[model samples]
Target chain A: MHESPAVRGRRIKKSFGDVVALDGVDLDVAAGQVHGLVGPNGAGKTTLLGLLLGLAVADGGELEILGTPVGRTLAVPDGVAGFVDGPGLYPSLTARQNLSALASLRGYDAGRGVDDALEQVGLTDVADDRIRGFSLGMRQRLGLAAALLTRPRLLVLDEPANGLDPAGKHHVHRVITGLAADGVAVVLSSHRMDDLAALCSEVTVLATGRVVFSGPVTKLAAESGALDYRLLTSDTAAARRVALDTPGIRVPSGGDRVQRPDADVLVVRGAVPAVEELVVRLVRAEVAVRELAPVVAPLEAAFLALTGAVPTDEEVS
Target chain B: MTTTVTPPAVEARPAPVLRGYRFELVKLLSQWRIRVLLLACWIAPAGFVAAVSLQSVLPADTVFGRWMHATGWAGSLVVLDFSRSWALPLLTALVAGDVFAAEDRLGTWRHLLVAVRSPRRIFVSKGLASLTVLLLLVAGLAGSSIAGGLAAVGNHPLVGLDGHLLAPADAAGTVLLSWACVLAPTLAFAAIGLLGSVALGRSTMGLLMPALLAFALQLAQLLPLPVAVRLALPSHAFLAWRGLFTGPAQTGPLFIGLAVSLAWAVVATVAAYHLFLRRDFTDLTYDGSGRRVLVAGALPLAALVLLTFAVVTATTPAKGSGIERAKVEGSLATAYAHLYRMQTRELHRPDVTEAQLRATASCDKGGSRVADQGPGNDWRCVVSWHLPGATAVGTAIYQLDVTADGRYVADGDGPKEVNGYFQVRTSTGDAPNPLWQFDGNVDLLASTSKD
Candidate 1:
């Protein structure tokens, strides 16, 4: 028999007073799969993540985590672990003490693999320092270390890469990828498009409390409309002229065609097929197209289009 | 991605509540603030005992203050009485009030709830931990006071209420029992503090609100109201230990007081737990708006005040109605007999028996025209007693301050020669008894009729 999905939500709904935080949200993630959630501010990403972790209960609809049905008691399945809206920690306690407290509260032997978990998050050096003095990056890493102590089967992290240095982000990425390899289903929400594209095989995009897109990473790229591209050519004039003559390709105002400010650079905006046609025409016309790349990554371009507005601080948090 | 080896499964336990309780205890004990508070509790009694022992005059206003300088046990009793006013409630509230709100202040509620699985379990664990800390504080303070008293003043027979003498061992037991009695009300205050903490979501407010409320309630007891209304106040239980010091050990008020106090504790704790279980942890911000304050704080207070008024109205009779003439006459006769016997003994006239004194008293309220029956502070009594050498009966006027609770303080204007300490004979051939002396004023409660 096929194993059940690690998480399944059907028409999940939640509201805070008059604000409808999540309306008819449905999501699923199988074991060993890393699913990415992307949305602008106030798109209900945090609300959905909170539901998965049992920090909150949906006002209406079905939610199942690790094969257990969610209830109104705010209790998730045993294996669900992660942080939303920043991790909760005791500032008076040291990093090591915080983890031990969590372990003891969970009825586990605190001495069991606390050190290993600390080392996994690269927090072993400052484990004895009080968390009050810790930087945001350090606190975020410590939160990850706390979650790892439970050996969770399903990880739900909201902006896990927040405030991380490059090395800390690399350590987190490795840990998340390693956990997924061990059949731990990870559902990560982030605004960093590169992190999502690099880590997630499937992505879900939320807009205004509803799922706007859900599929493989490639599908999201395909769904993106015409995106701007930065083109570098040996013959910028020939490339600009070819672009203007093309059916669906248009040289933007700042391109060589308008100002000729940059001798060998051009800017174009068009669909992939039209850009390809331009490239083909340029090569056939001996324009010598050296390089062509979208100005922004497809995931970000699609996210901006899907969200259609800048996110407010409240929604981002 | 590479798969890592899985560790062995840890043994699972069924009792999450016990684990949560243990964790809460660890968290509470680990705080430096709590440790310092307990240390202060253990050490402050010695300084207080030393400071109070140096006073030339006795602290005569409190229950056992008159004898506090005369005996160590009385000194402990004095401390116990003083602490009941505010110190005990504040001590219990200091820890119990912060028990849950500290988690909110530290942003650990969500973490704790997610780990513990049951919010009720978390609530129970926190409450139990707070109770444990409160018990420890009480024990520490009691033990320290007893130790300080023993070291500063030697143990001696305590002067009981109404001129009854308590043996040294009995006095020590009574003092200890009084301290123990205060614990019930202290726990009630703790419950109040816990409720405040859960409702307010801030540690400072939790700590201060219960203490302020208890102080206000204690002040309310001093207001002129029916005896039943006063009895209903939680502070009434703090004075219940006085029953243990009285003759024949009246336990009616003690039992009733304990029941009232425990009922308050149970109600507050249950309400706190109910609120906690239903509260949403996602947003722990306390909205201290006018409407919220009216609903959360003022409504309960208004209800309590109305209930007190209703009880007073239902129980209190019309004017000129509380004290009965027969009861007053009987109690005055008995008290006069007791005091007159002690007086003759102090005057070296032990040959005079209570029967020889033949005390008969007539009492009136405010003035002779006013009926001698209502509960009022102004009361007067005329007593005719036989003096050993006098040819006829001697009449002395006494001013009595009568309380609604059947307690009275009588000031006698007798012979001027008997004002100062005089020679006393305890038994045949005993040389001038010095310790057992008499004052012009006497305090006593009315006698309970056996029928």
Candidate 2:
């Protein structure tokens, strides 16, 4: 199997006068997979996306997109499509007209294909509506449709799901999944960890323009120091007994203890799958376990630990 | 996890500027504003010529002449007039002002840069599109002027105020070329608007600055100054177009007008290109770009002002007339006797034969000194003659004004001038004579005797 990256960057740095936007970053996105980049505000995730989209060039190190090597003076690559920051849209143009203009520029025979792309983005009904009237989510979808019209091999999207409702997010996720299934590489930068987790099998967490962690999401969860377990039990004593026997487990203390002592409830921390094994063992031991949930959400906990920045309330959601 | 890779069905190719430009043209042409502007381009010159032509035909008492008559080839469009000098510039401003500014007003500059492949490409494409539109707009104005003039005014012998009739061939050539002269100055305005559009990043300033500059140039030309500064201004081109109508038309001013406007356009366009390409537009702060300071603080305005001031002061007359001693009585007696002899011998009556007139004038005043005829300063005079059974009378007028350089004044006020005609009224009861007038101020380049 080929190990070469479809897109790669090493030790990339970008600065705007007195402001350091990106510093000593490394990233690689292989073909046929979706790579999610997540970070808190000012973490330089958008900067990295800018680098990939050819909107900004790194000040140091080498960057590559698809098979094309890039330098600080590199032009936007031929077959790469995506949005950095937010999509640039002609607000006066109708959705279909915008797509058609893009298609015409690319010399594509956009005939009925613009309609098809609109349908794919679930914007067919509003294809004739001017983009000025579109919601943020709808505009995002239209941008996606524009990208799809070019049939790009590498897609770099920044915070694409920020304004999407559940169904809209689902639709976006499905479309991204379908693209990945067709062997298109996607580099998605988002502030929403849940969205990243749902859509990306592999993830990179950046902090201060450097990648703090990059690998499979499951690996990140497993390697995390501790997993939070939410427990529901018919008998509190039985759940406590199971947890006590479980090695490498700690129960919440102080105000963290919210459950009534006579009723069934418990909270504990351990390795994720290990805690799951313990719960199975407890059920086998005939202690009724009603619910199990992670209290220290792995993605959230990882984000806080990696960034070392306090997660805002919005981020926690 | 194992991933499955499938070969893509197709590869995408990059787009070219030609295709991009076509789309741009489509957008520009589809706008209702552009349609209205084009319509105005057609109507304005036609309407101007029609109005002038109607005035010319109604009454001879009105200050109407062949110059007011629309050129024969351009049908109803009046090619020569004071109103067109200002009107054409305004018409140019109406269209050229909005070229790049419209995009800024619509908030499309950033959007276009992103949607297009690059800003450099966008700049070039948009510039070309604007130039194309300007050409079309100028053509429409010129074409309508020609068409309207020919249609509205009947093709008759155009007797100029000087009693010279412009032939069909000469009039056609002059009107066409004159309209073209307007284009040279219009380009300067176009460039100004474009620079404003890019530098200020607002459409209104783009339009306003150019229009204002053109009007400013026109005002500057009116100030007391040398011929050079007057000729250098963009508005001079408007006046340069007047050359086509005048007898023995001088091409020098037209060439100077062309050169000045071309230089202005080139300098402005180059400056605009530099600022547009170098400025960090990512920030998109319109005012903070520093373009205004650079453009406004340039040395050209100061240089032109100082040059004008120095030239005007140095050239204008120090006081009033220095030759005030050459006054009326002595010269008036000689002038009358000389005038009497010339009338008796040369002027003929309706009933008298030419042979009979010669026998009447062997008078001593028949050959008087030239100086005895009149005072140099007197431009207007009345004289009498004898026609068959009636005393024939007429006016022999002279108007003189020295140049700013204190040059001598030249006098020839037979008929036409800028303001109106000075008629030569004869008392003979013949058909009513066509009155001639001196319409403009006269300045002496050199004396006919000295030449």
Candidate 3:
């Protein structure tokens, strides 16, 4: 409803003694958007997220959360609620008690709110059960439920999909999406590229505490450049022959150091048009292509490229 | 960006610190350890009384133990003084030492610190919650001890340090006041425990720290340290109650110890809060199941407080100069005459007055080679007095066991009918003869030179 972005951080710098956590990082997440942070270990993804949640203040930077500039206090703003690292839950308390305790801390008489949050996270079944016995996935779900209790306008979650089962994953996805649909801005960090692509409209790729790329997920997938196609066919010999003859399409050999052994699938590297040419030629040759797909998904490939991470053997081939 | 509208905000805005304290209190009371602590404090003293009452042998080593068979108040006092100085610090640690450290252990600091908005609030809330629990624990311990003692023994008169007899009503009042004075050292130790938790941020360390300090101080009592150093320690505050039962209620050490203990508490708590605020919570939160709930620790803050209070206490004259021979002799003779008169009344015999019975004591510390002086367990005294029907004077030989802190137990070794025994035949059934074996104390700081 307001003009300012839900979370706006500029040139943020945080250091622990000698190690720099976030250096000159700039982030802007609009309301009603699920902004994904993609980074490898120690890339300052969690650190940046921590600054937003007020778990830690930047050594230098300007941050505004929900129109309020974040201060040196170890607390989020009035409309902000999130957890970095993980939801720091009390294992001794039941899922319901954990939420109620947090709510009580905020002076919120969240008797019904606790039940609603638990039910919202599909944890109504184990609401009274202590979290000490909760599995990793269940804990993650409960963490989300705790964050939802405040009805945060800006929610920050670190690895929101880390330990979720299929059902739990779907439940979290729906909650995050629903929150965003209701005008909540969510910023979550995850190592899962699929999660980033599926849930986030915009992604920020951080490496060594600096944002290497920040834009729409669609624009990020476009940066993948070329593709490595895995061709599985009814006639492997025929498909392999057509792929070798096609221009701009080079079939990988067993001698290549990056070659991975595939018993019945042929790997080819080419631009989209070239791969399209090869597919047309294969169709003319009456070779039925059973499976033809990029060896690594586009978003993951672009993330691997932008972060300067070493490509996997399959992607390299 | 599209605007879909967010949910309505929560409107109530109470004081964050009060809310934080309430939350912490709820969480603290829910912990199994905290509950067990409360339960133990409630029942353990009663259990002690029950066990001690079943036997004839008195727990005579303690100040009030010898008279426990006569008065339940004495039994309560005995329990109150039994390892009191040593146990209180550890007990305080169990409640407070792990308070802040537990947040680190359970990885709940993120949630608590975030919601509370200020670390100061968190500190204050946790401190207040711990103090609340400690107050409850102390009340329970004191109440149960008195209840157990009254139930186990009847409300007979108790003996005080100056060998004065306290009526049942007076004894009850004194015990309550002693427990109140106990809060001085207790708060000091609790602050020390909080300092340990905040400074170390580890449960085991927090728990071990207060226990270690307590043991060290207890052991320190054996060493010939400077009296000034001894007077300054938070541990020294435990002995503050000694002055309360002394003749004229020697209040110097009581007031000094109260000031010293308060200084220790305030400074240590400040140091802990300072450390807590400066800490950066950048470490990854531990989600391990191996985590122990708020364990307990010690801190340099205790040492800092010790030296600080010590410096202040050092400027004053140090008490604990040991019981004087004359003071002991006088206290003993006065107690003997008082109890003898009371004993005659119980026997339905002719009444005797303290003025008529000229009781005098001649005591030697070690042997005939030594003059009657100073504090020692080996004291022999001849208490000669007059009886109403006897023509000649009667004498009672008493073996005196004295302590450096100005208390003694005098064992009567005369004929049972004349001096006393465990029980004596009285007109109203068998009754406790107050003249048998008696407990008393001399003011260590009382004027020793009787001119």
Cα RMSD for candidates in order: 6.9, 10.1, 5.4
lDDT winner between 1 and 3, please give it: 3
Please give each candidate's TM-score: 0.81, 0.70, 0.87
Q: lDDT per residue, candidate 3, A121-223, as tens digits? A: 8999999999999998889888888888888899999998878988889889999999999999999999899998889999999999999999999999998
Q: Give the per-residue lDDT of model 1 (tens digit) for A178-286.
A: 9999999999999999999889999999988999989899888887778877788897777888999999997766566422355556778889999999989998998
Which candidate has the highest lDDT of all?
3
lDDT of 2 by residue, A93-194 (tens): 789888888788766767787988899999999988878788989988888888788787888887788678789989989999999998899999887778
DockQ score of candidate 2?
A: 0.16
Candidate 3 per-residue C-alpha lDDT over B1-451 given as tens digits, one digit per residue, 9 for 90 to 100:
1222222322323337877888889878988998998998889987787668656777877777766666778766776786365557777878888888888887777766667767788889999999999888888788888888888777777767655668889888888998888787788788878877876676476666677777787787544444455556667667668667755686765776677778778877877787677767766643211122122113454465567545644555443444557777888888788778777777777988877888888787898787565556689888989876678888888889876555578888786776667666643235556677777766544555572
Off by over 4 Å in 3: A227-271, A277-290, A312-317, B1-15, B83-87, B224-227, B285-327, B342-363, B367-376, B381-398, B412-422, B425-436
**Which stretches of candidate 2 lie above 4 Å from their native place?**
A1-3, A72-74, A112-115, A124-133, A162-168, A219-301, A311-317, B1-15, B44-118, B155-164, B202-207, B281-288, B292-451
- Single out the weakest 10-residue window by summed lDDT for candidate 3 chain A: A254-263
lDDT, candidate 3, at A185: 96
What lDDT does candidate 3 reach at residue A22? 83
Scored by DockQ, the top model is 3
Error of 3 at B179 (Å): 1.5
